[model samples]
Target chain A: MKLTINRNYLNDAIQQVSKAVSSRPAMPILGGIKIDVTHQVIVLTASDTDISIQSFIPIEQDQMIVATIHEPGNIILPAKVFVEMIKKLPADQVSIEVEDHFRTTIRSGSTEIQMVGFDPEEFPLLPAIDQNEIIQIPGDLLKTMIRQTIFSASTSEQTPVLTGVLWNLKDNVLKFVSTDRHRLASRTAAITAPDQYQFNHIVIAAKTLSELSRLIPDQNTMIDIVVAENQVLFKVDNILFYTRILDGTYPDTSKIIPQTYETEMVIDTKSLLEAIDRAYLMSREEKTNIVRFMTIDEHTVEISSSSTELGKVTEQQKVQSYKGEPLKIAFNSKYMIDVLKVVDSEQIFIGFSGTMRPIIIKPLDHDYNTYIILPYRTVN
Target chain B: MKLTINRNYLNDAIQQVSKAVSSRPAMPILGGIKIDVTHQVIVLTASDTDISIQSFIPIEQDQMIVATIHEPGNIILPAKVFVEMIKKLPADQVSIEVEDHFRTTIRSGSTEIQMVGFDPEEFPLLPAIDQNEIIQIPGDLLKTMIRQTIFSASTSEQTPVLTGVLWNLKDNVLKFVSTDRHRLASRTAAITAPDQYQFNHIVIAAKTLSELSRLIPDQNTMIDIVVAENQVLFKVDNILFYTRILDGTYPDTSKIIPQTYETEMVIDTKSLLEAIDRAYLMSREEKTNIVRFMTIDEHTVEISSSSTELGKVTEQQKVQSYKGEPLKIAFNSKYMIDVLKVVDSEQIFIGFSGTMRPIIIKPLDHDYNTYIILPYRTVN
Candidate 1:
């Protein structure tokens, strides 16, 4: 196998696939990236069992030749070393040639590096999946949807299905919901498709979506998402991202979200976020991370937290509007902080049902984002 | 104690002293910074066992009132927490009041934090040191000298004296030397002081100097360095930096440095550095990090390294000049890389004594810097 490719093009492509490669893969061959070069394009692929990334660089792009392949073949090179080598190469063009012993030679400028590689046959091939049902969504919006919900997923392995963000696509709107059983975050966006094509309970791992988001360029270009029985594929430009679909029935979370609220208050997002942030520093030492919020008057709210060892912090700020009985509730400050991060509006409406009930936060001007946080019982 | 100071001014002062504070200090009170307030100044002091830093923020400077003190007293606040709190304060000016029971109230805007702090009396007092034998050096140059030689010091605690950089001053020349018994780095600079204030073998811990280098502002102002029996102090602006001198005499490393050499080659420092850097990656996998250099011809030098598992990297670079017998030698690439980083000339002179003897590297046109690296023995 012999090929000469543009340094920047190869570097970027290798980096994209390398994220799917694991350093401590179960099989040694799984730690390598498969490189396949044909008459038209050079394909770089990496798989770490849960997810696989394949990126292709065409021989000629935009009337300019990016790669010239003298011979078409394939080789499996160690992902970590190959990426570093290509990045540090001296010239703008790099040539790679593989010999019978699976020995690879990489040359650029006056520097030549020869390294041992694994056989491509030992590596896993891309899994075959039925891609009849396809949905197109804007890349920028998809990335935002992933970011807004992924962080709410459970990191623990005890509940396997809770580690993924649930996707429900129906009526041309794609809704994402992620809950770690402690807190839940949901976001919805309207797409160009119609209700004729609908898919539900398609769970994708939070980590998988995080990697896919990074691969997609930040633009308004359309990205094709193909669904299968147990595998889902996201296509961004010439790159294909395949991930395993989680197996389980998602719990019905709507039963827990209160249909009616006992109190509602509108406050500046920035002011409340900052106030809770300061209070969090002290509560962090108490091990509970509980910060208390009390409504003092029609236009007043108090954010405070105290620890027997770390002392106390109290911050009072006037809200834009408040319509609720004067009360104080304690909850995890981190949940509030995370929910406030994705608030698209300057003012956010916060509704509380009871001291022990889950509090809801919604964007004041739009119905696109909503967050629910469970409060902790505190003895006043 | 009561004072209202500019937030930024107090924040910057606390950060500088916080460097000397340790997270795992032997004494609990040592984890706090002593705050001393007077009619004219507010001093922040922090000290770990190895180093102590004191910074004074004057109430008035440059015809501007920076702080207004209503009362004068002292208190100790936890270094880490206080610094974070001051940084997050909402108001431009922050008022700090220390009352009975060591309860400190820090108020800024509508936010107030009350925390229990240790009594200032529990903190250790600064050690008394002789201030008569003082040597003056420019702050910027002192920082440069430390950066050039500190990395050469041994990081292992087995060799206590080798972990300290040796300072020898005579005839208005300040020379710093550090070695780990395998390699030695020395730098010399002439200062604006007379020979009457000469001192020799004043050893300071490399870690202490590293922290001190960060405290000194990047300016050309003169800094007074005071030498005592077992301590050294540096005064930069209004900050007083003190470090305990290491015990035991530094080894005589000058004997290992060769006065003359068998072969001398002058090469571009950057080219040789980069070549070795690439080769080092392969040699690093072999466990020795040994990169070999051979004089191929009158003006050519070959740099190469190989591992049976990771393959090899070879680079051929042209030199400015070469003399004497053509030879091949091996040395630790990491040491070469570190020494090359501090070379002051574009063209550096590399001299070899033998295959196993120590090599010397210095600036081609000047004798301001010298580095000696012991070569590795290779079976050819």
Candidate 2:
């Protein structure tokens, strides 16, 4: 097989697919990227068993000859090294030739790289899918939802389901929720899908979801997500991302969310974020990383943290308003800071019932960005 | 002890001296920075046994009251955390009050930090030298000299002297030489020194030398480097960096560098560096990372590398001239690439005597940088 392609075009396609390539694959052949040169187009595929990314480069890109194929063939080349070599090649056009013994030669200008390749037949085939059962959402919206909730997913594999984000759809709306047991983040958005697009529970690994987000460029492009029995496929313009679905059921986290509040205060988001950040830096030397908060007046709130080894820090910030009784409470400063970063609001309202009760943080204008953090006990 | 200093001024001084503070210090007291508040100035000092850095902030910074002396006193605050706290403080001027029990109160704006301070009397005092053997050079030039030769020093402590750079001074020139036995780098620059300031051999640890460079700002100001019998003091503006000198004599690397070459080749420094970089990336899978070069003709050079596991890469470049005779040589691409990166020249002339001999890469003109690398044997 022989083909010539524009170096920049091939580099872009290879980079998109290489995101799914695993440096240490369970199967040796899985470490390579499968390249298929057909009469119409050149396709690149890379997979790490859990997630597969595929991109197709058309014969013509912007009135330029991106690829000219002499024969229809396929070969699997080492994904990581070949991609790096092609990126460093000096010429504008690159030619690739595959011999009968699975030897691949990539040449551009005066630089030529001859690498050992594996037979494309040995690489795993893309799983078959019924494209009818799919949910459609804008790429940027999906990426935003993933970014907000994915960080809360448990990184450890001890509880497999918690390592994935629970995606549930109901009444033409898609909801994404993630939690590591200490805190939870959920985002919901409307989608133009049938009300009966029957899906009860689907947990996709947080890492796979994040990789899918990275593959999609930030645009108003739409992606079709299809969840089969045990695998999921995302179809974009000339690209496809497939990931395996988690097997276990996710826990019910609805009850832990606060339904009522005894006291509420509205504070500037940036000021509170900065105050908590300073408190967090000081609390790092303490055992619990605890920071205390109290309503000093109707328009002022105080934040403080103490460490026997490092020191103690206390600061005050002015807020828009405060209600109910004045009180002092302690919570993990890092957790509060994390929630504030993702909850993008100019002024945020925080509700507290007591010292050990969960604190609810939400935008005062009733937007969908709401977060709750369980407070640590302060024995005062 | 009481002091109110401008936060920016204190932060800058702390950042410079904190480089010498090591958390896992050989001496426990070295973990904290010594703070001495006198009538007129506030002094901050940090030491890690091998190196000591001290900086003073006077009372005249923006008419800010730096120190009131309240009874001149001293204490040591944990270096790493204290610096971080001061950086995050809110107020422009910070007031620090130390009680008799060593409880330190640092107040800035509404933020208050109470930290435990250790007795500053336990801190190690740097060796004081009375003999004034000093050489003066531009701080920027001294920083550049340190950056150029310090990377070649031996990292292993097996032969302690090899881990230090040998400084030789005579005839108004200060020469710095460092070698790990495999390769050597030496730089010579003119300096202003008194006639009595003569040193045949003085070794300073490469780690200490590099840290001292960071303390020198981008001002074209001159710094006095006083080299004593057992200590080296770098006095730049208000900053003083003192380092314990390595005692043993360094090896004589002058005889190993070849003065003449049988074959010489002149090539564009940027092109040669880029080609070597490409060859290095391909040779990552090989055992020795060896890249071979052959003088093909009067104006052509061929570069190639092959690994049984990853296959082969070959590149060729056209040059201005190849003198003497046709030659073939192989060397560790990583080492040569590093040396090429630091050599600043548009055109570089490489000189070689034999395949097994060390190659010297110098600028087409002696006014530019020079580098030398040892060749590795290629397997037949």
Q: Candidate 1 chain A — worst ten consecutive residues by lDDT sum?
A: A78-87
Recovered fraction of real interface contacts per model: 0.68, 0.82
Residue-pair clash count for candidate 1? 0
Model 1 misplaced regions, further than 4 Å: none
Candidate 2 per-residue lDDT over residues A276-329, each given as its tens digit: 888888888775778989888888888999877777888888979888888789
Worst 10 contiguous positions by lDDT, candidate 2 chain A: A363-372
What class would a CAPRI assessor give candidate 1's docking? medium
Restricted to chain B, the TM-score per model reads 0.98, 0.95
TM-score of each: 0.97, 0.95
Per-residue CA lDDT of model 2 for B23-63, tens digit only, reads 79776568899988888788899998888889998977566
Model 2, runs deviating above 4 Å: A378-380, B61-72, B367-369
TM-score between model 2 and native: 0.95
lDDT digits (tens) for residues B88-128 of candidate 1: 88889999999999999999987999988888988887889
Tens digits of lDDT, candidate 1, A1-380: 99999999999999999989987988877888899999988999999989999998989989888999999999998775567877887789999999989999999987899988898888887889777777899999999999889989999988879999999888889999999999999999998654498888999999889989988897677999888878898889989999999988788886877888888899999888888888888888788999999988888888998878767889987789888677789999988998888777899999999898999999999888889999999888
Cα RMSD (angstroms) for every candidate in the order listed? 1.6, 2.2
